[model samples]
Target: MRIIRTPASIYLFSISVIGLLFFTFLIKIPQHSDWIVMFALSGSILLLNYYTILIPPKGNSLSMDSSIYLASIFLFGLHSTLLVLLIYSVIFAIIQRKIAWWKHLFNFSVYSLMIICSYYAFILIDGFTGPISVKNIIPYLLSICTYFSLNLLLVGVYFVLEATENIINFFKEILKETTATYISTLVLSLVLVILMKPNHLFGLSLFTVIAFLLSLAFKQHFNLFKEISEKANKDFLTGLNNHGYFKEILEKEVTAAKENEQPLCVVIMDIDDFKKYNDLYGHIQGDHLLQEFGSLLKASSDAANYIVARYGGEEFSIIMPNTDRKTAYSFMNELRKKVNDTYYKGVEGLPYGCLSFSSGIAECEKETYSVSELLNKADQAMYAAKNQGKNLVQLYNGHSEYSVQRSLSLEKELEEAEFQLKIFLSKDVYTYRHSKRVYQYAVDFSRMLNLSVDERKTLILGALVHDIGKIEIPRDILNKKGSLDPHEWEFMKKHVTYGKDIISTNKKLEDLIPLVELHHERYDGNGYPYGLAGKSIPKLARILCVIDSFDAMTTERPYQKTKTFQEAIAELRHCSGKQFDPQFIEPFIAMIKEFETSGDEQHKEVAASIVN
Candidate 1:
């Protein structure tokens, strides 16, 4: 219904007008005796529609009204069928007056069109109208098929117009779900025709009663199944999704987030000093506390469609789709304050003298390989919050963990990176020189952009190893001296992945993986790897792309011609938004012009300093 407005309104209006015209032309005045039968059939259709049988799981329904209409068409012919339709439509419109008047008119038109088409199809196929016989089976099948196809076409067109994405998948799902149900309903109509051949009123009465009973039986089964499913998926104590079910949903959401390139976050929280409260009170009182805590979490998270689950004793988790880590931290921090203010029984005996919790958030990133890894990051952050005296929210930071282990100074880290870069010297000397020049440009550019001390270090280090993946490429391709073939060009692109894998061997350098893998991505979403566009790529990676491409354009490569500094700057201007980020490219060009204006000797001195 939300899909019907403007163009859809006009579409429905046109179809309804055509249907009314068809109904007016096809409808005939029934004989005085046949009027009684038409009214009876119309009443039967109304009753059947009112008591539609809802299938379990998805809540789709089976309405027997179509069977009644098909039986009427076969028994009483076209005029009687239209008369039944008219009576049913008028009464139904009056009963369901709460629905929009236009929608009612549209529905009437759709049914009218279906009846008209099916009647013509039956007649054209030489269907016999008075009795049920084996000879007319082909006509009966054709007419029912026509009715089914017309319904699918009309409804499908409207929905397709409403939501254009995945149009082919939509029709396939509709056909798969509805084909069996529709076939059974149509076959039932034939059974009715056979029964009514002897006596109209008695056969109609028996069919209605059987259908009503079947609807009641199916309703009971659907209810039972729903209740059992809820029990299986929910935690008995907290009334939230159980650990297994939560993991199941998180895995699926993780896959969807990766495929659609959307942000997803997970928060793991633990109640601070919960064991103290449990020791003071019995385990039964602790159980009650857990229940209350789960209820609070569920109520707070319901508005965001977040999946909240009891991860274990005193620990709870929430999976937030399309949310980043910063937003997740803010929300959880607010919840922490709220929990502190809202007191629970015996919380006075606790450390903070009220309810309190520690939470940590981790956002999905390009480097996040699996759900377990993401959960581990959140767990680490949660422990970090606990170590910070509890009752706080922390966002996962990779550097925080590495600082505790290695804690290498910047100069030492630079030496480690330079050692890795030296491998390119023997394998591909051109690449080694290019990387060094790019590294130098990055140092100057980072200072010009007013980057932080840490950011400046990361940018310079990442620039040095960004092309480390090229180590895996064949020497013939790297120093080809001419254009590469299509296959060879594809093999050259694997260098980014190789670099990422190479750096991943050392946990301290995990922060540089995005720069190594994503520096080749374009600003307009045309680059290789993930094709991430605009700000979705990391800020450092975007800055590095401008520097990398600029150096590649100005420097001499075996297979490419070199451009002067002036020509390179002009090329950067032309491809600002396409190949490089406009925000960083303009500043980088300014820095190059500064070097050009200062003196050639100053630029050589900076290069010599980098070599030292």
Candidate 2:
């Protein structure tokens, strides 16, 4: 007979043979001395076995029965442990009618192996066979661990075959996740042993009551933890990922894609003329639009491959891993059509006449772009779609030449912005040079992030003009060699608003207002002015904040001592999520290192061109 061949079949056959031996062992050494005690323990355990707590989504289970089984091993030794385990397995199999006969046999054998190994492990360590004591603690601990290890091995082998994943990784994950529960089980088992020592029948009955009560408590606690975790990861408004969670996933996906040399696509989309819709219908209706739209995206995408998130306000983003730009664009085109067909209450009144969105797509191409750059390129494409009268899809690619016209148009205006920045002369030598350094940082960051020509133009202008508001601050406050007083610091916080006002006066620089106005806003909503937080801060503004702050720290600021490059980087890492948008931190650090490696001459040239 081909009883043992394939891994599963071999396990099945081996367990069946082992179970046959255990049954013979139980038959030979019947526990005639404690018939009443065994019967009561078995009956109580049989009832307890029917109820179990399920870990959601995966539907894996935990049971309090392990404690009783362990206690039985100490009370009645190997023979009773096997007998109780066999009876428990049979009743459990009967309740779970869908479980195959062979699986039942396997589970029985698994229990037999674990209990026998534990029984021997206890004896080998000189543990007492009955009525445990604190002196036997070492033996008891080793016995329990032996049982746990054998149980893990038996189940892990099957998991390895079924999951087709790395065995070590699976073991590590399993061990980490279940350590708490297992340790709790061990403690409970020891308690059961103590209880059973005092009149086994009465002790077992009381322990059974306690076990069921504890199981119900654990179930409630697990559910509560699951709910809180879900809330933490989700956006309160639309039920998509919050900004913090979205970046976390994006970083993970990007790293995996780069390591595997797989394609990762980013789509940054904006609902066309959403502000008009909001103004016409009010903020309540505007929120309804966001909710309705987010629901549609979440439902349409397969969550395993694509993650759709509300990218703050009217913008939404989809991160699609293992997908190229073409596939992603095609997918977005279909999604766009779906949205266009679905009428919303406020969409009909807008310029587009119906609800529509503009989307841009970009793919990861090794050294060509980083995670932020992939998203930026996608953002650029979305803007390109918006510029093409909105409600369309565009791919970030080489064929685009609208970039040329934008750069040419912004050249003269950029020169003027630099001339205006000369006003920083009266503040301090550091203030005059800081904008130059920030501007250089922005240029390299823009390239690394794959900003479109228009985006790069706007960012460069914003970086050059971000501190133009400081031009109006008193020379004493600007050049102060010490920290500003409370009143003076409060005044310093108005630079973003001031910069926005100054830039808005010139129509050519009007698009730069967000960058000027929101740079000081922190990721955690603690920064000044409006205190806008997370993705609510415009992407460019967030990018400029990182570059601008790095320059402020590393350069000779009047109020703070300068830092070395390494010290400054450590500070950035320390405050990534709280102080700056974490998405840009890695890219900014990489750009600085590259700039250093290329020699200081190139850095000098980039910074000098901003004001020279």
Q: Which candidate has the top score in lDDT?
A: 1
Instruction: Give the TM-score of each candidate.
Output: 0.69, 0.63
lDDT of each: 0.85, 0.78
lDDT for residue 496 in candidate 2, whole number 0-100: 75
Mark the regions of model 2 whose C-alpha exceeds 4 Å error after superposition: 1-27, 33-36, 39-62, 252-264, 302-305, 321-324, 364-374, 398-612
Q: What is the lDDT of candidate 2?
A: 0.78
Q: What is the C-alpha RMSD of each candidate to the true structure, in Å?
A: 6.6, 11.1
What would the per-residue lDDT of candidate 1 be over residues 238-313, giving only the tens digit for each residue?
A: 9999989899999999877875678999999999999999899988999999999999999889977788999988
Clashing pairs in 1: 469-499
